[model samples]
Target: MRLAFSLFVAGFVTLAAPVAAQSPDPVAPVKEVMDVTVTNWSDSVDEWKGIFEGDRLNRLYTKELVELYKKASEKAAKIFESEEPVDPFDYDVVTNSQDGCPLQDVKIALAGEKDGVSDVAVSFRLWACEDNADTKNLVSEVHFDVVQEDGKAVIRDIHHVADGERDSVIEELKAIIAQEE
Candidate 1:
């Protein structure tokens, strides 16, 4: 009985070792952001506010991106205090639009790694909650640059394409900050 129990324990340890030693998925942060975006599509104000102001900002985004976002937010706040208040980001940065529907056929994959950063490709079709919505015009794609930070994967930048126009979140944020200054 003692020998049998010892063998069982050893087998359990061996089986668990591989699972415990697996590396973190580089695409996890991208998937998480997409999931949150889709799930909170109806509550854009609070959801985005939480992502920008709460701990999720630091947990999911790189330091440089976070700094840029903070600067933009500060500038927006200052403008809000002025006589003519204007929203710096009129559209949702993630979707690159002011309107979005529930996501369907969502796909997230780690495309490749370059210079220690991983490229994550995300594509989805907008489900308008209709039985016969045109799916062709509702497709969207975004790419995320992720890097290891503190031994965890975090998003460094986001690239969005819409209507044959290319946009980078980092570049947009910098442009917004520069335009105001």
Candidate 2:
């Protein structure tokens, strides 16, 4: 009876050992690398305009960010508001161009969000963001890459390549960014 019991115990140990080894811990890959992507803002200017025109800037920006955008937009519009009647939603009028820049895709990615700061990556479509001969030193588009600070999104830098038609807009934005004292 003792010899039979020993044999059974050994067999059970071998089977259970193999089963435990086959199971994988689900949390093994918990430490993952994340990448935040920042993309050019002007590439998809028209597309973004469409989204915001149908919706509200508040849906897309924080309250502070929206306020800044509003101030800049209003300032620029005031500068050229007399150029023609603009509906604000009408890019044809906003740009005052019979034909405007083609659609270019701009995207931002969040690699990781931790503590108070977020890691991001950004880029834009240079081909579509370029200036035309008619702009005459105006900024057709401005792309901003920012790190949010103190409950506000602060632009780390700006990328501008436009003609005269867009200069007022660029200057207005620079003023707004600078005013975040």
Backbone clashes in each candidate structure, one number apiece?
0, 25
Q: CA RMSD for every model?
A: 4.3, 13.6
Candidate 1 overall Cα lDDT vs. reference?
Answer: 0.77
**Each model's TM-score, in the order given?**
0.75, 0.33
Query: Cα lDDT of all candidates, in order?
Result: 0.77, 0.38
Deviation (Å) of 65 in candidate 1: 0.6
Candidate 2: C-alpha lDDT: 0.38
lDDT of 2 by residue, 15-42 (tens): 7775543322211111110011111133
TM-score of candidate 2 to 2 decimals:
0.33
Shift of residue 91 alpha carbon in model 2, Å: 11
- Model 1 segments more than 4 A misplaced: 1-22, 42-50, 82-88, 127-137, 163-165
